[model samples]
Target: MNTVTRAHLCEAVYQEVGLSRNESSALVESILAEICDELVAGHTVKISSFGTFSVREKGGRIGRNPKTGEEVPIAPRRVLSFRASHVLKDHINHAPASGDNDADGTR
Candidate 1:
Protein backbone atom coordinates (compact mmCIF):
# COMPACT_ATOMS: atom_id res chain seq x y z
CA MET A 1 0.00 0.00 0.00
CA ASN A 2 3.06 2.23 -0.09
CA THR A 3 3.99 4.51 -2.99
CA VAL A 4 7.56 4.74 -4.29
CA THR A 5 8.61 8.24 -5.21
CA ARG A 6 11.49 9.67 -7.23
CA ALA A 7 13.26 10.53 -4.01
CA HIS A 8 13.03 6.90 -2.93
CA LEU A 9 14.67 5.80 -6.16
CA CYS A 10 17.41 8.38 -5.80
CA GLU A 11 18.06 7.23 -2.27
CA ALA A 12 18.22 3.63 -3.38
CA VAL A 13 20.76 4.49 -6.06
CA TYR A 14 22.80 6.48 -3.60
CA GLN A 15 22.90 3.59 -1.18
CA GLU A 16 23.59 0.85 -3.69
CA VAL A 17 25.90 2.69 -6.07
CA GLY A 18 27.95 4.73 -3.66
CA LEU A 19 26.87 7.91 -5.36
CA SER A 20 26.31 11.31 -3.82
CA ARG A 21 22.72 12.24 -3.16
CA ASN A 22 22.75 14.91 -5.86
CA GLU A 23 24.36 12.57 -8.38
CA SER A 24 21.89 9.85 -7.58
CA SER A 25 18.99 12.23 -7.99
CA ALA A 26 20.34 13.52 -11.27
CA LEU A 27 20.92 9.99 -12.58
CA VAL A 28 17.40 8.91 -11.74
CA GLU A 29 15.97 12.06 -13.25
CA SER A 30 17.97 11.62 -16.43
CA ILE A 31 16.78 8.04 -16.87
CA LEU A 32 13.15 8.96 -16.30
CA ALA A 33 13.39 11.88 -18.69
CA GLU A 34 14.82 9.64 -21.40
CA ILE A 35 11.97 7.19 -20.98
CA CYS A 36 9.41 9.96 -21.17
CA ASP A 37 11.05 11.42 -24.25
CA GLU A 38 10.95 8.06 -26.01
CA LEU A 39 7.30 7.53 -25.19
CA VAL A 40 6.48 11.04 -26.34
CA ALA A 41 8.27 10.36 -29.60
CA GLY A 42 5.94 7.38 -30.25
CA HIS A 43 8.55 4.80 -29.34
CA THR A 44 8.11 1.89 -26.99
CA VAL A 45 10.47 1.58 -24.03
CA LYS A 46 11.35 -1.89 -22.86
CA ILE A 47 13.50 -2.79 -19.88
CA SER A 48 14.66 -6.33 -19.59
CA SER A 49 13.26 -8.28 -16.64
CA PHE A 50 11.17 -5.26 -15.72
CA GLY A 51 8.41 -4.09 -18.04
CA THR A 52 7.53 -2.40 -21.30
CA PHE A 53 6.05 1.06 -21.54
CA SER A 54 4.12 2.01 -24.64
CA VAL A 55 1.66 4.49 -25.91
CA ARG A 56 -1.58 3.27 -27.41
CA GLU A 57 -3.89 5.16 -29.70
CA LYS A 58 -7.59 4.90 -28.94
CA GLY A 59 -10.32 5.82 -31.40
CA GLY A 60 -13.03 8.28 -30.52
CA ARG A 61 -16.27 6.76 -29.33
CA ILE A 62 -19.68 7.64 -28.00
CA GLY A 63 -20.19 7.37 -24.28
CA ARG A 64 -23.25 7.68 -22.11
CA ASN A 65 -23.61 10.05 -19.21
CA PRO A 66 -24.50 8.16 -16.06
CA LYS A 67 -26.49 10.90 -14.36
CA THR A 68 -28.61 12.28 -17.23
CA GLY A 69 -28.56 9.29 -19.57
CA GLU A 70 -27.26 11.48 -22.37
CA GLU A 71 -24.91 10.39 -25.12
CA VAL A 72 -21.55 12.16 -25.34
CA PRO A 73 -18.71 12.04 -27.79
CA ILE A 74 -15.40 10.94 -26.41
CA ALA A 75 -12.28 12.26 -28.07
CA PRO A 76 -9.59 10.02 -29.46
CA ARG A 77 -6.42 10.04 -27.42
CA ARG A 78 -3.18 8.26 -26.72
CA VAL A 79 -2.72 6.35 -23.51
CA LEU A 80 0.40 5.08 -21.80
CA SER A 81 0.43 1.52 -20.57
CA PHE A 82 2.85 -0.81 -18.86
CA ARG A 83 3.17 -4.55 -19.40
CA ALA A 84 5.33 -6.32 -16.84
CA SER A 85 7.80 -8.89 -18.10
CA HIS A 86 7.41 -12.53 -17.10
CA VAL A 87 10.50 -12.31 -14.90
CA LEU A 88 9.05 -9.37 -13.06
CA LYS A 89 5.66 -11.00 -12.77
CA ASP A 90 7.13 -14.20 -11.39
CA HIS A 91 9.26 -12.30 -8.90
CA ILE A 92 6.23 -10.38 -7.68
CA ASN A 93 4.06 -13.47 -7.48
CA HIS A 94 6.65 -15.53 -5.59
CA ALA A 95 7.97 -12.83 -3.33
CA PRO A 96 7.77 -13.64 0.34
CA ALA A 97 5.48 -11.58 2.47
CA SER A 98 6.59 -9.87 5.66
CA GLY A 99 6.68 -12.17 8.66
CA ASP A 100 6.17 -15.23 6.42
CA ASN A 101 8.38 -18.31 6.65
CA ASP A 102 10.08 -20.09 3.76
CA ALA A 103 9.33 -23.64 2.63
CA ASP A 104 11.72 -24.97 5.26
CA GLY A 105 10.03 -22.82 7.92
CA THR A 106 12.94 -20.44 8.20
CA ARG A 107 12.04 -16.78 8.23
Candidate 2:
Protein backbone atom coordinates (compact mmCIF):
# COMPACT_ATOMS: atom_id res chain seq x y z
CA MET A 1 0.00 0.00 0.00
CA ASN A 2 1.16 3.53 -0.67
CA THR A 3 1.78 5.69 2.37
CA VAL A 4 -0.56 8.61 2.92
CA THR A 5 0.94 12.02 3.60
CA ARG A 6 -0.53 14.50 6.08
CA ALA A 7 -1.90 16.91 3.48
CA HIS A 8 -3.58 14.17 1.43
CA LEU A 9 -4.85 12.53 4.59
CA CYS A 10 -6.51 15.74 5.69
CA GLU A 11 -8.12 16.18 2.28
CA ALA A 12 -9.43 12.61 2.17
CA VAL A 13 -10.89 12.79 5.67
CA TYR A 14 -12.51 16.11 4.94
CA GLN A 15 -14.14 14.70 1.83
CA GLU A 16 -15.49 11.73 3.76
CA VAL A 17 -16.81 13.72 6.72
CA GLY A 18 -17.93 16.82 4.78
CA LEU A 19 -15.58 19.11 6.59
CA SER A 20 -13.92 22.05 4.87
CA ARG A 21 -10.25 21.75 3.99
CA ASN A 22 -9.36 24.41 6.58
CA GLU A 23 -11.29 22.61 9.28
CA SER A 24 -9.83 19.27 8.35
CA SER A 25 -6.31 20.61 8.29
CA ALA A 26 -6.75 22.33 11.63
CA LEU A 27 -8.25 19.24 13.19
CA VAL A 28 -5.44 17.07 11.90
CA GLU A 29 -2.88 19.54 13.19
CA SER A 30 -4.50 19.64 16.62
CA ILE A 31 -4.57 15.87 16.88
CA LEU A 32 -0.94 15.59 15.82
CA ALA A 33 0.11 18.33 18.23
CA GLU A 34 -1.68 16.61 21.08
CA ILE A 35 -0.05 13.32 20.26
CA CYS A 36 3.35 15.00 20.25
CA ASP A 37 2.68 16.69 23.56
CA GLU A 38 1.69 13.41 25.17
CA LEU A 39 4.82 11.73 23.89
CA VAL A 40 6.97 14.54 25.22
CA ALA A 41 5.27 14.11 28.59
CA GLY A 42 6.15 10.42 28.56
CA HIS A 43 2.52 9.30 28.36
CA THR A 44 1.09 6.72 26.03
CA VAL A 45 -1.94 7.60 23.93
CA LYS A 46 -4.25 4.67 23.27
CA ILE A 47 -7.06 5.08 20.78
CA SER A 48 -9.62 2.41 21.49
CA SER A 49 -9.94 -0.18 18.70
CA PHE A 50 -7.02 1.48 16.89
CA GLY A 51 -3.64 1.40 18.53
CA THR A 52 -1.35 2.75 21.21
CA PHE A 53 1.48 5.26 20.68
CA SER A 54 4.38 5.40 23.06
CA VAL A 55 7.81 6.94 23.29
CA ARG A 56 10.83 4.76 23.97
CA GLU A 57 14.33 5.80 24.96
CA LYS A 58 17.48 4.17 23.72
CA GLY A 59 20.80 4.52 25.48
CA GLY A 60 24.02 5.44 23.71
CA ARG A 61 25.71 2.50 22.07
CA ILE A 62 28.56 1.48 19.84
CA GLY A 63 28.35 1.81 16.08
CA ARG A 64 30.37 0.74 13.08
CA ASN A 65 31.57 2.59 9.98
CA PRO A 66 31.24 0.01 7.23
CA LYS A 67 33.43 1.97 4.81
CA THR A 68 36.36 2.19 7.19
CA GLY A 69 35.56 -0.84 9.38
CA GLU A 70 35.93 1.42 12.39
CA GLU A 71 33.86 1.41 15.60
CA VAL A 72 32.05 4.62 16.55
CA PRO A 73 29.94 5.85 19.44
CA ILE A 74 26.26 6.34 18.73
CA ALA A 75 24.21 8.87 20.59
CA PRO A 76 21.04 7.99 22.43
CA ARG A 77 17.66 8.85 21.00
CA ARG A 78 13.94 8.68 21.65
CA VAL A 79 11.69 6.76 19.29
CA LEU A 80 7.95 6.50 18.94
CA SER A 81 6.22 3.18 18.36
CA PHE A 82 2.66 2.12 17.71
CA ARG A 83 1.06 -1.14 18.76
CA ALA A 84 -2.18 -1.95 16.99
CA SER A 85 -5.10 -3.11 19.06
CA HIS A 86 -6.37 -6.63 18.50
CA VAL A 87 -9.57 -5.44 16.88
CA LEU A 88 -7.73 -3.30 14.34
CA LYS A 89 -5.22 -6.04 13.65
CA ASP A 90 -7.95 -8.60 13.13
CA HIS A 91 -9.90 -6.44 10.68
CA ILE A 92 -6.81 -5.60 8.63
CA ASN A 93 -5.55 -9.15 8.60
CA HIS A 94 -8.78 -10.93 7.61
CA ALA A 95 -10.86 -8.39 5.71
CA PRO A 96 -10.25 -8.06 1.98
CA ALA A 97 -10.22 -4.69 0.31
CA SER A 98 -13.05 -3.67 -1.99
CA GLY A 99 -13.08 -5.31 -5.47
CA ASP A 100 -10.99 -8.21 -4.23
CA ASN A 101 -13.52 -10.92 -5.01
CA ASP A 102 -13.21 -13.13 -8.11
CA ALA A 103 -15.89 -13.80 -10.71
CA ASP A 104 -17.44 -16.38 -8.37
CA GLY A 105 -17.50 -13.68 -5.63
CA THR A 106 -15.46 -15.87 -3.32
CA ARG A 107 -12.81 -13.82 -1.57
Candidate 3:
Protein backbone atom coordinates (compact mmCIF):
# COMPACT_ATOMS: atom_id res chain seq x y z
CA MET A 1 0.00 0.00 0.00
CA ASN A 2 1.14 3.52 -0.71
CA THR A 3 1.20 6.22 1.95
CA VAL A 4 -0.36 9.60 1.31
CA THR A 5 1.48 12.52 2.85
CA ARG A 6 0.83 16.23 3.35
CA ALA A 7 2.77 16.93 0.17
CA HIS A 8 0.47 14.68 -1.80
CA LEU A 9 -2.59 16.43 -0.37
CA CYS A 10 -1.14 19.83 -1.17
CA GLU A 11 -0.46 18.77 -4.74
CA ALA A 12 -4.00 17.48 -5.12
CA VAL A 13 -5.44 20.70 -3.79
CA TYR A 14 -3.22 22.77 -6.04
CA GLN A 15 -4.35 20.80 -9.08
CA GLU A 16 -8.05 20.71 -8.27
CA VAL A 17 -8.49 24.22 -6.89
CA GLY A 18 -5.85 26.01 -9.01
CA LEU A 19 -3.98 27.21 -5.94
CA SER A 20 -0.26 27.86 -5.79
CA ARG A 21 1.85 25.13 -4.21
CA ASN A 22 2.67 27.22 -1.14
CA GLU A 23 -0.96 28.29 -0.75
CA SER A 24 -2.16 24.71 -0.94
CA SER A 25 0.42 23.64 1.58
CA ALA A 26 -0.57 26.42 3.96
CA LEU A 27 -4.25 25.54 3.60
CA VAL A 28 -3.63 21.92 4.43
CA GLU A 29 -1.54 22.85 7.46
CA SER A 30 -4.16 25.27 8.74
CA ILE A 31 -6.93 22.68 8.54
CA LEU A 32 -4.78 20.10 10.29
CA ALA A 33 -3.85 22.54 13.03
CA GLU A 34 -7.48 23.37 13.65
CA ILE A 35 -8.39 19.74 13.98
CA CYS A 36 -5.48 19.16 16.33
CA ASP A 37 -6.45 22.09 18.49
CA GLU A 38 -9.97 20.80 18.89
CA LEU A 39 -8.81 17.31 19.71
CA VAL A 40 -6.30 18.60 22.22
CA ALA A 41 -9.11 20.49 23.96
CA GLY A 42 -10.98 17.16 24.41
CA HIS A 43 -13.44 17.93 21.67
CA THR A 44 -14.47 15.68 18.84
CA VAL A 45 -13.94 16.86 15.28
CA LYS A 46 -16.48 15.67 12.74
CA ILE A 47 -15.73 16.05 9.07
CA SER A 48 -18.66 15.51 6.80
CA SER A 49 -18.44 12.45 4.51
CA PHE A 50 -15.06 11.61 5.96
CA GLY A 51 -14.68 10.66 9.61
CA THR A 52 -14.63 11.81 13.22
CA PHE A 53 -11.50 12.36 15.27
CA SER A 54 -11.72 12.16 19.03
CA VAL A 55 -9.49 11.96 22.02
CA ARG A 56 -10.00 9.07 24.44
CA GLU A 57 -8.70 8.73 27.93
CA LYS A 58 -7.13 5.40 28.80
CA GLY A 59 -6.89 4.38 32.41
CA GLY A 60 -3.70 3.05 33.84
CA ARG A 61 -3.46 -0.71 34.01
CA ILE A 62 -1.10 -3.54 34.68
CA GLY A 63 0.45 -5.15 31.68
CA ARG A 64 2.65 -8.16 31.25
CA ASN A 65 5.88 -7.98 29.33
CA PRO A 66 6.60 -10.65 26.79
CA LYS A 67 9.87 -12.61 26.68
CA THR A 68 10.71 -11.65 30.25
CA GLY A 69 7.40 -12.67 31.84
CA GLU A 70 7.56 -9.56 34.00
CA GLU A 71 4.63 -7.48 35.14
CA VAL A 72 4.73 -3.82 34.15
CA PRO A 73 2.64 -0.84 35.06
CA ILE A 74 1.06 0.80 32.06
CA ALA A 75 0.73 4.54 32.38
CA PRO A 76 -2.58 6.14 31.66
CA ARG A 77 -2.62 8.48 28.70
CA ARG A 78 -4.87 10.15 26.22
CA VAL A 79 -5.12 8.55 22.81
CA LEU A 80 -6.46 9.80 19.53
CA SER A 81 -8.98 7.72 17.63
CA PHE A 82 -10.75 8.01 14.32
CA ARG A 83 -14.13 6.60 13.37
CA ALA A 84 -15.13 6.47 9.73
CA SER A 85 -18.44 8.04 8.89
CA HIS A 86 -21.23 6.11 7.22
CA VAL A 87 -20.67 7.96 3.97
CA LEU A 88 -16.99 7.19 4.04
CA LYS A 89 -17.69 3.54 4.81
CA ASP A 90 -20.13 3.33 1.93
CA HIS A 91 -17.73 4.97 -0.46
CA ILE A 92 -14.92 2.66 0.55
CA ASN A 93 -17.10 -0.40 0.37
CA HIS A 94 -18.42 0.45 -3.08
CA ALA A 95 -15.24 1.78 -4.65
CA PRO A 96 -14.52 0.34 -8.06
CA ALA A 97 -11.63 -2.07 -8.19
CA SER A 98 -8.70 -1.10 -10.35
CA GLY A 99 -8.46 -3.30 -13.45
CA ASP A 100 -5.26 -4.84 -12.20
CA ASN A 101 -6.59 -8.36 -12.19
CA ASP A 102 -6.21 -10.49 -15.28
CA ALA A 103 -6.14 -14.21 -15.74
CA ASP A 104 -2.52 -13.89 -16.81
CA GLY A 105 -1.76 -11.71 -13.77
CA THR A 106 -0.73 -8.74 -15.91
CA ARG A 107 -2.28 -5.30 -16.04
Candidate 4:
Protein backbone atom coordinates (compact mmCIF):
# COMPACT_ATOMS: atom_id res chain seq x y z
CA MET A 1 0.00 0.00 0.00
CA ASN A 2 1.15 3.52 -0.76
CA THR A 3 0.96 5.88 2.18
CA VAL A 4 1.49 9.65 2.06
CA THR A 5 3.35 11.30 4.92
CA ARG A 6 3.87 14.83 6.10
CA ALA A 7 7.00 14.95 4.02
CA HIS A 8 5.03 14.20 0.90
CA LEU A 9 2.67 17.10 1.63
CA CYS A 10 5.57 19.37 2.38
CA GLU A 11 7.24 18.47 -0.89
CA ALA A 12 4.07 19.02 -2.88
CA VAL A 13 3.51 22.39 -1.31
CA TYR A 14 7.11 23.36 -1.86
CA GLN A 15 6.95 22.37 -5.54
CA GLU A 16 3.66 24.08 -6.21
CA VAL A 17 4.18 27.27 -4.26
CA GLY A 18 7.95 27.74 -4.51
CA LEU A 19 8.21 27.77 -0.73
CA SER A 20 11.29 26.64 1.19
CA ARG A 21 11.23 23.09 2.52
CA ASN A 22 11.07 24.31 6.11
CA GLU A 23 8.23 26.72 5.32
CA SER A 24 6.29 24.01 3.51
CA SER A 25 6.69 21.66 6.46
CA ALA A 26 5.58 24.33 8.87
CA LEU A 27 2.50 25.10 6.76
CA VAL A 28 1.51 21.46 6.64
CA GLU A 29 1.93 21.06 10.38
CA SER A 30 -0.09 24.18 11.13
CA ILE A 31 -2.97 23.05 8.97
CA LEU A 32 -2.99 19.63 10.60
CA ALA A 33 -2.84 21.14 14.09
CA GLU A 34 -5.80 23.38 13.32
CA ILE A 35 -7.83 20.43 12.15
CA CYS A 36 -6.97 18.43 15.25
CA ASP A 37 -7.75 21.32 17.55
CA GLU A 38 -11.23 21.68 16.10
CA LEU A 39 -11.89 17.97 16.34
CA VAL A 40 -10.77 17.91 19.95
CA ALA A 41 -13.19 20.74 20.61
CA GLY A 42 -16.04 18.57 19.20
CA HIS A 43 -16.39 20.66 16.05
CA THR A 44 -16.62 19.33 12.52
CA VAL A 45 -13.96 20.37 10.04
CA LYS A 46 -15.30 20.46 6.51
CA ILE A 47 -13.10 21.06 3.51
CA SER A 48 -15.30 21.53 0.48
CA SER A 49 -14.83 18.92 -2.24
CA PHE A 50 -12.68 16.93 0.14
CA GLY A 51 -14.43 15.51 3.19
CA THR A 52 -15.74 16.18 6.67
CA PHE A 53 -14.05 15.17 9.90
CA SER A 54 -16.07 14.97 13.07
CA VAL A 55 -15.96 13.37 16.47
CA ARG A 56 -18.65 10.98 17.65
CA GLU A 57 -19.37 9.89 21.18
CA LYS A 58 -19.78 6.15 21.57
CA GLY A 59 -21.65 4.72 24.52
CA GLY A 60 -20.18 2.00 26.70
CA ARG A 61 -21.46 -1.45 25.86
CA ILE A 62 -21.04 -5.08 26.79
CA GLY A 63 -19.12 -7.19 24.31
CA ARG A 64 -18.45 -10.91 24.32
CA ASN A 65 -14.96 -12.31 24.08
CA PRO A 66 -14.80 -14.88 21.31
CA LYS A 67 -12.01 -17.00 22.81
CA THR A 68 -13.16 -17.09 26.42
CA GLY A 69 -16.88 -16.59 25.84
CA GLU A 70 -16.87 -14.01 28.60
CA GLU A 71 -18.78 -10.74 28.67
CA VAL A 72 -16.59 -7.64 28.85
CA PRO A 73 -17.38 -4.01 29.28
CA ILE A 74 -16.33 -1.80 26.40
CA ALA A 75 -15.47 1.67 27.53
CA PRO A 76 -17.10 4.54 25.71
CA ARG A 77 -14.93 7.03 23.86
CA ARG A 78 -14.97 9.78 21.30
CA VAL A 79 -14.03 8.58 17.84
CA LEU A 80 -13.14 10.58 14.78
CA SER A 81 -15.05 9.85 11.59
CA PHE A 82 -14.51 11.07 8.04
CA ARG A 83 -17.21 11.35 5.42
CA ALA A 84 -16.04 12.05 1.89
CA SER A 85 -17.73 14.67 -0.17
CA HIS A 86 -19.45 13.77 -3.44
CA VAL A 87 -16.60 15.25 -5.46
CA LEU A 88 -14.04 13.25 -3.56
CA LYS A 89 -16.06 10.07 -3.91
CA ASP A 90 -16.43 10.61 -7.61
CA HIS A 91 -12.71 11.23 -8.00
CA ILE A 92 -11.94 7.96 -6.21
CA ASN A 93 -14.42 5.96 -8.28
CA HIS A 94 -13.16 7.15 -11.69
CA ALA A 95 -10.23 5.81 -13.66
CA PRO A 96 -7.23 8.02 -14.28
CA ALA A 97 -6.70 9.52 -17.73
CA SER A 98 -3.58 7.41 -18.28
CA GLY A 99 -5.58 4.21 -17.86
CA ASP A 100 -8.17 4.94 -20.53
CA ASN A 101 -6.26 3.36 -23.42
CA ASP A 102 -6.60 -0.26 -24.55
CA ALA A 103 -3.75 -2.77 -24.64
CA ASP A 104 -3.16 -1.88 -28.30
CA GLY A 105 -2.68 1.82 -27.30
CA THR A 106 -5.90 3.09 -28.86
CA ARG A 107 -7.32 6.16 -27.15
Q: Say which candidate scores most in lDDT.
A: 4
TM-scores for the candidates: 0.84, 0.75, 0.84, 0.86
Ranking by lDDT: 4, 1, 3, 2
Q: Residue 106's C-alpha lDDT in candidate 3?
A: 32
| TM-score for candidate 2 | 0.75
**Tens-digit lDDT track for model 1 on 44-90?**
99999999999999999999999999999999999999999999999
Best by TM-score: 4
**Model 4: lowest-lDDT 10 consecutive positions:** 98-107
Candidate 3 on 1-107: residue-level lDDT in tens?
Answer: 54668987887788889889999999999999999999999999999989999899999999999989999999999999999999999987884577435423331
Model 3 RMSD to the real structure? 4.8
Which of 1 and 4 is ahead in lDDT? Answer: 4
For model 3 the TM-score comes to 0.84
Which residue pairs clash in candidate 2?
none
lDDT digits (tens) for residues 1-107 of candidate 2: 44557987687678778888899999999999998899999899999999999989989999999999899999999889999999999988885766455423321
